[model samples]
Target: MDAPGRARREARIATFVGLASLASAMGIGRFAFTPLFPLMQDSAGITLAQASWIASANYLGYLVGAVASYVAAVKAPLAARWGLVVVAASTLLTAFADTVARWVVLRLVAGAASAFVLIGASAWALALLARSQRLRWSGWVFAGVGVGICLAGLTALVVASVGASARWAWVGLGVLAAAVAALGWRAFATMDAAVRPARPRGLGALDAASWTLILCYGIFGFGYILPATFIPAVARAIVADPRVFAWAWPLFGFAAAVSTIAVSHLARHAKPGAAAGCSFIVMALGVFLPAVGTGLGTLCLSAICVGGSFMVATMACLQQAQRVAGDASGGLIAAMTAAFALGQAVGPLTVTAAAPLREAIARPSAVAAALLLVAGIALLWCEGRTARK
Candidate 1:
């Protein structure tokens, strides 16, 4: 093959590796618990309060990991490898934990590992793609999260049908994560040596555009997480049959994956901020659906809207950050990610504190919708300011 062909091939391989790694890290490590929460409650007698705490613990760890990524000074590939391994181990260990405390600790560890995996893998993959002049592949790379979510949701559904416990479901997801990590291991083997480390930049280095991206990204986190975390539970509450409700999460994942790729293509011609702002508006509508329309159709539509737009919004914001920050995008990315993690950490806790378990669902959904609308307006304002400048 010619040089150009070889580069394209390599870029394709790297994109696939990034996708698999993301699936393992974000899909299985971070979100597998969401689908399994109801199962744990059904089989192990776990309470909503306990589940909310576990989710919060994971989000807290994600925040810590995102913050650490800015100053940790590790090579991206090395960090990714370590992150994948730890995520796999933590996921497997969760299956053996007998207490809620143990589960929380394991989830926290998983959350931290997932953050490292996402940040490291993204850095490594995007750098490689850019070097090969295949930067357009990034949307597909980001879509890996949705693919992973779909896989996990389907796996949980299958396991539940067999009357397996949540522990078995965790084990199954851990095995899948391990397999994906092993497949992507070679892609990162030379990444550290090939690329120089990024220089550290503080928050003070950010310009107006970067700050706007960060704040909006944080709001996106808070807005999408309530539905992302609770969609399965909400569906289950409406439909007693696991068979019927189990489809919600997979549908959510499918919408997420597809929407990201579509938005990615659109982003080539459109301004990233405008694309993101529109996505937020649509996502806000999705979040509001369940509050006003309680039927199964509304629930599924809500899942579609929220899942489809969240990752697209993420892709657009990150791309916008790269455009505005250029070489100093590393610190900006970390800061934005940390802000997002903080928002996620607050979502479930807000619900836990605000209402009784049975009545908690609608309030959080409403809050998420409101936050998303605010984020949309903020993004639009930033875009207008940039245009005027």
Candidate 2:
């Protein structure tokens, strides 16, 4: 109720709201295409590989955007506020593009814009926190991805319920994203700013441990994304509820947010690698649940597992990299981000390869479950050994 306490509380709320809004716009909104891919492909008469390209194009743009923003020294605090506007506008434009080529270009632009918005907002959030509180605040801020994912999923359901066409869904998402952007703009505009300028640096500055961390992160990327990309489709296959398609993503997002917050606490007491390994174990269990259970509850549980582990491991890896690499945060962040994008790029192909097995196993969840379990085992081996040393 006091002045300083009230001020601090307000500041924290601003950061949380700003970060969450950015996540909804950039992290969740832009990436919704992955979950929506099957539906879009079916409606648009595109191939799976082509659908994959749409997703890839977005990430490719993200890489370019992140790099470009770093190089331009574009006043991140200022950029963060506006990036959401641009991203939202771009999301809306994606609705107008009719051809695949046009969609690709639009998505690419959207991706780049999203990167600027998210990275800028995140950097600002971290900078605002005291040094002692930075890591925990950053972890909480990162939970925006989960929140965004939930929003996107909820939107998808609403759009689907109206029996809207795929094109309409795209338009709806764009408009919704823009609306969220406006709210974000308002939230960050009047609040005190916290970001300071830092010049972009190259990855060569990263040490051996940093490189190891990046590689481990890449594995996490490859392992976790398969479920993220395919789980909705897998859910569609098992549960007959047309509504399941809409509900699946929100469920995933909700689970992801909860898991990120819960495991972040765990990260304080445990080795980061150990925490990551345990996360993967959970992911493996969640991804496979439906194949064995084939019920709606299984679908919800699977979402919980994948969503929770999705970013917890990512944050832990980044934190570990910062600790081990020291002052090489820029390079380590870049490497980890790049590896994650690459893992996501390869995820669909991995799922596609298991197509024949889907028929035999009677579920795609089975394949995803096996993949995550193997990934967890690898993470456990790495972490367990690292812990022993």
Candidate 3:
């Protein structure tokens, strides 16, 4: 084979491995909690209050993981591998843990691992792809998150159908993470991050537009998370059949995966902020839809709209950060990550505080939708400002 052909082949492998890494980390490791909520409730008789606390533990761990990755310098490859291992162990361990406290501890570990794998695998694979000039395949790499979520959702559905325990779901996903991590474990053991460390910058140094961008990202997190956690439950409320309600999460994952790939191809023409703006608007609609319609069709559409747009929103926001901040993009992105985590962390807690949400999902979802809409406008306004400059 010619050198060009060989390089392409190698790029393909890197992309596949990268996809596997993210699938294990983000999809299965980080997000398996959402899909498993109902199963746990069924088998464990877990309450909403307890579930909220447990879910928040993972988000808190995510925040800690992000901070740990930055405070300490670790090789990307090794971090990715160990992160995968921890995710598998935590997930596998969750199956046998007797108390909710134990589950929270395991989830916290999984949460931190999710961040490590995300940072490590992304840094390693994207750098390799850039060198190979196959950066377009990055979309396929990220689609792994959606793929992982889809698999978890489907697994839960299968488990529910067979009258199996939630433990089986966790075990299957844990094994899946282990298998994927082992698949592409060796390639990144030597690869460093894309380059030398970025210059240290802080929030105080960011300009007003950049500040606005960060806040918008946080709001995006706050806005979308409520639905991400509850879409299945909402569906369950609408329908008694496990088969019908269970489709919500898988549909969510499918939309995320497909839309991510589609938007990547559209990157040639669309500005990142502009793309992010559109996604937010669509997501806002999805977030608010079920509130008004009260039907399964509306719920399914909500899944597609929110799921389809979230990754696009993430990709666009990061791209916009890079465009606006340049070398300082690292710091800005970190701040954005923190804000996003905080936003998500606060999302579940709102359930605990809001008396209305228990009686009517409409009020809180409406609030979330409004936030998303406002944030979407903010992103567009910032993009327009940047374009004019």
lDDT on C-alpha atoms for all candidate structures: 0.84, 0.65, 0.80
For residues 133-171, what per-residue lDDT tens digits would candidate 1 score against the true structure? 888888899899999999999988998888889899999
Total backbone collisions for each predicted model: 0, 1, 0
How many Å off is the CA of 180 in candidate 3? 1.9
Q: Once all C-alphas are superposed, what RMSD does model 3 give against the true structure? A: 2.2
Residue-level lDDT of model 2, residues 46-148, one tens digit each, is: 5655665777777777667666665666555566667777777777777677788987888788877776775566555554554325356666776888877
**Candidate 2, TM-score vs. the true structure?**
0.81
Over 4 Å off, model 3? 1-3, 73-75, 197-200, 325-329, 353-360
> What C-alpha lDDT, on a 0 to 100 scale, does residue 165 get in candidate 3?
86
* TM-score of every candidate relative to the true structure: 0.95, 0.81, 0.93
The root-mean-square deviation over C-alpha atoms between each candidate and the true structure, in angstroms, is 1.7, 4.0, 2.2
Clashing pairs in 1: none
Model 2 pairs whose backbones collide: 256-307
lDDT of 2 at 196: 44
Query: Worst lDDT window (10 residues) for model 2?
Result: 353-362
Ranking by TM-score: 1, 3, 2
Candidate 2 residue-pair clash tally: 1
